[model samples]
Target: MDTTLQDPLVGRLLDGRYRVDARVAVGGMATVYRAVDTRLDRVLALKVMHPDLATDAAFVERFMREAKSVARLAHPNVVGVFDQGADGAYVYLAMEYVAGCTLRDVLRERGALPPRAAFDVLEPVLAALGAAHRAGFVHRDMKPENVLIGDDGRVKVADFGLVRAVGSATDTTGAVLGTVSYLAPEQIEHGTADTRADVYACGVVLYEMLTGAKPHSGDTPAQVLYRHLNTDVPAPSAVVPGLPAELDELVACATARDPEARPYDAVALLALAREARAALSEEQLDAVPPQARAQVRSGAEDRTSVIPRVLPLPVEHTSRLPAPPDPGPAPGRGPVTVHRRTAFLVVAAVLLSLGLGTGVWYINSGQFTRVPAVLGQTEAQATQRLADAGLDVGTTERAYSDVYERGTVMAVDPAPGERIRGNGTVTLTLSRGPRIVKVPNLKGTPLEEAKKALAAEGLAPGVITYAFSRSVAQGAVIGSDPEPGTERSPDSAVALQVSRGAPIEVPDLTGESVPDATATLQEAGLKVVVAAERIHSPEDAGTVAAQSLAEGSRAAKGDTITLTVSKGPRMVAVPDVVGMKTDEARGELEAAGFRVKVEKTFPFLGDTVTGQSVEGGTNAPEGSAVTITIKGL
Candidate 1:
């Protein structure tokens, strides 16, 4: 059925910008579609949150967060997010459209892949993840389905909807969000995840690619989850026999039950994968195991096996003779006369030819040869050994090792005793010694620069925490996990404590009373200093008029928060109106910013002014009252 036609979103324009054309894929959280940007006229993938999920505020936030998070990452192998918006019920993110199948598709068709092919796919995946991990984001859901293998062979990691900042608490409230097959043990047990979880998923992916099957499987998701938490992931070699030991070790390192035993991040795992690839011989990398689906016939013997066999036909001979001569002879003598040796010889020759052809086919194409053992040998020595055995070195790579000396071979592909063609190539992995590194002192270094320094020293910048520092500047490193002078493996994460300068946020004290504002500022780790002289202002008397630091501005502990108090409105002088007309006095007093009230001493009196309050011409508070007594007739 063409489900895309039934989908309402198909053929509709989303946000009036993206013209959704056809549905590409559907996932638990959202449905992906092929769309064109009407404004930009570029093809892209539109990931629209499911209507049900969109109604949930938390899910919508997480969906939009995926867009924002992926957009910040500018790596080539990471899928790009161009825009995020909503059109009616459809909230969608327009992402870069990769036109090809997924790693899962390849596995479904080909079963297990050769080591080289598996590495080819896995290395790019790890590269994309390494970028995300370094950027301090974890791809909480990493599976073959999220790995997009473009038609042009470019690999991209997608679907960061579950991504969260490192050190975030796990959600034990509900079922985990990732596929059961790829979920890390911690993710299954505690619902917690970190960069190492992604590493574990990639390791499981690598295992799947090498063996053409998952490490653990069950009838239900719960059972699978239980296995992830309880069982150790068996090595790929266990299923695909003859897989390189380095591969087993790589899988073991990645899928370790304990998160701490795994690589700190994808970048570290990538290094190990490259090292494993280097140690394998070409024959080992391309070796076709029994578990792989037989898709193509590689040799002439396979071609011959498909040809129809020619069956021998039943033979009958009729002998014609002069009628009476044979009648007198015995019946046994008559049959002996008809025997033809020439015909029998021809039949025998054809059968002999068929037998010889089958033998030639087997000798020319069906013969197998064993890969010579070449462990612990130099690259030149390994190459010469393979050449003496009619094989060639395919690829050479260096890997860190504690047992093998530097420049000597550490491992070989086909496991030193696997069967391969004589003309095949052997990949040699040379030793680079142990990967030991010291934690560099990053104290006093800027946070961003400290991260770069750690990366340069073959270390990863782990979780960042902030603290108030008296001597160190803000955004500078206060210390690190494992501290300085500690020796650790390469790509180990070093947690950094960065100085937050001083713990202070200036309080908004515009209208607060002097006492209240002072207490608030003091409580916020600041010293309050009130100016001695009061300033005249419109604000209420004794309220704060101004502050040294602006509202919400950052400040250091014990930093003084200078304040200017308000003394209320300025006072105005009252005008003198003694012996003046009552109306004139009232007008003069009112004009001098004082309210006037008349006090008549006699009824029906003349409009002459009488005694006035405050003796007139005296200063009183602004907007104060003045009283004057008028004389009667």
Candidate 2:
């Protein structure tokens, strides 16, 4: 088979207006071509389902539904569908024609794009996906091939609603419809897909764009699928030596095995991609040499003047169609005729019939149908109301609201009572309610105090406690309750604590003179009292000789104790007993309470005192000592 053989659809008229020019791309179920709209004289892309697939009623119904679903989508980055119709054996969709390479083509040509360039490319795709997600459509099979970059550097995402048909078990013709390298972990394992599934695929696309390699791979599709299920995806940095930490983190986040680990949906991923694009480091920018940057600038130049290659269509045996009439002409190539007269007549008849039918439609189109007001109503109510009004309730969307209750209608497009064409769509936005967040208060306070304040504000306080002092005393309320100003729920509790005075220990003042101790005790807020005591020495007179209580005892306040002071010792005088017998002298000294020290100097041999040196009972306090002397014979 000659690869150069042209597709039969090329230059063929479709629906009597669109003329297929060149094949652009072919997928499992459809072949897309560049076409010229004769009626509008504009270039358009046409996707025609394979005749074999269209033969199946189920596939045809799904294809038509998918077309309708995607046609409802309106976004700058998304390719717009113009019309959908069945012409003979062909079911084709006229869509927007973008004249740029697919991101796949770019990837094949340049192994890996710069990290910045990758994000720049992905930003629009994510935006498109986000819009679809918000509209409740999931682009389950997101990949670089579905992305197209225009010569003007505009990015447009294609292939929105066809994924359902591709994933259907009945549609399995053994052709792998999806790019295996990009399937998410759950998409591979459970074959379950959702908005987050799309996010995971987008992450894989970004990874390949950044590192020039898929995060996971195997010898076969099944192996690749297994890898997605079992293995952890390595970061882009691991493949390319020096990718930005943030970009690496983003890739990891996007390709996470757990769907919940990835961004909630494309909208969140789009936000992250935009942030990554803006935050590209100077080093990454500098790494792309001026020459390489120039190539990127120059590669973006228009090359439409040189005819690009047309995508090849699957070879099939052609069945002969009725011949068209030959028009007589006298050019160098004899009578110029294309097809037999019968074929031309049939074609003319079809065109004529369509024109008449369209004219009838135009006249009938003047009929007015009022779109009922369905704002602020539930989906079921809105649908019933629209049905009652002979209008169709089309798209339903969930959106955040500040005033409206959840599940209630936020708004509707093509406002009520407006005249609209037959089967016009009614876009409804459902309310999710305003965002509510618990208040966090930390104001005019120390760290601990602030934390308590926040807790009282109904927010779980994060402790950032650090010792701080203000007019507030140490370890006291620096200032709290609720910080100076913060929004909090009514009747919320605010934490508070009073300050504790500085630490102190009682002073011990034990033994000291009464005068000195009095001064010391007075300074320490203690009073001193004197207790009576007798002293033996004059030097010890009137001093604090003893205390009623021992020292070093703990007392709180106003405790009293007595101290004993000293008076001088009393002196006793000597008593005299002379010229009497020894027993009589001892008796006299004994009566005076003085022990006698007697010495006998008498010449008489008897043991008796003859004389005394001092008289008895001398003036003295208490007992006095007496000295005795005796005369010799």
lDDT for every model? 0.77, 0.66
Show model 2 residue runs off by greater than 4 Å: 1-6, 167-178, 289-633
> How many clashing pairs per prediction, in order?
8, 14
Off by over 4 Å in 1: 161-178, 295-633
For the record, the alpha-carbon RMSD of candidate 1 to the native fold, in angstroms, is 25.5
Model 2, position 236, has a per-residue lDDT of: 75
Q: Candidates' TM-scores?
A: 0.45, 0.45
Q: After superposition, how far is residue 472 of candidate 2 from its true place, in Å?
A: 99
- lDDT per residue for candidate 2 within 1-633, as digits (tens), equals 122146888646788777665677778778998776756656679999989887888888888888898999999999999999999889989999886678777666556666656766788888999999999888877888899877556789988988677653223233343377777777776778899999989888988877776787655567767788888788877767767788888888888999988899999988887777678755563243111211122221222211112211111223244553455553665432433455677788689768975654343333445566555567888888888766776888887654456887656666443446656678888888754435443333454665565555445543233233334454444433455454444445445443332322234333345687566655554556776554443224565556555565443223455666655334555555555777887887767656567665545466556666555455543334455655455
The TM-score measured for candidate 2 stands at 0.45
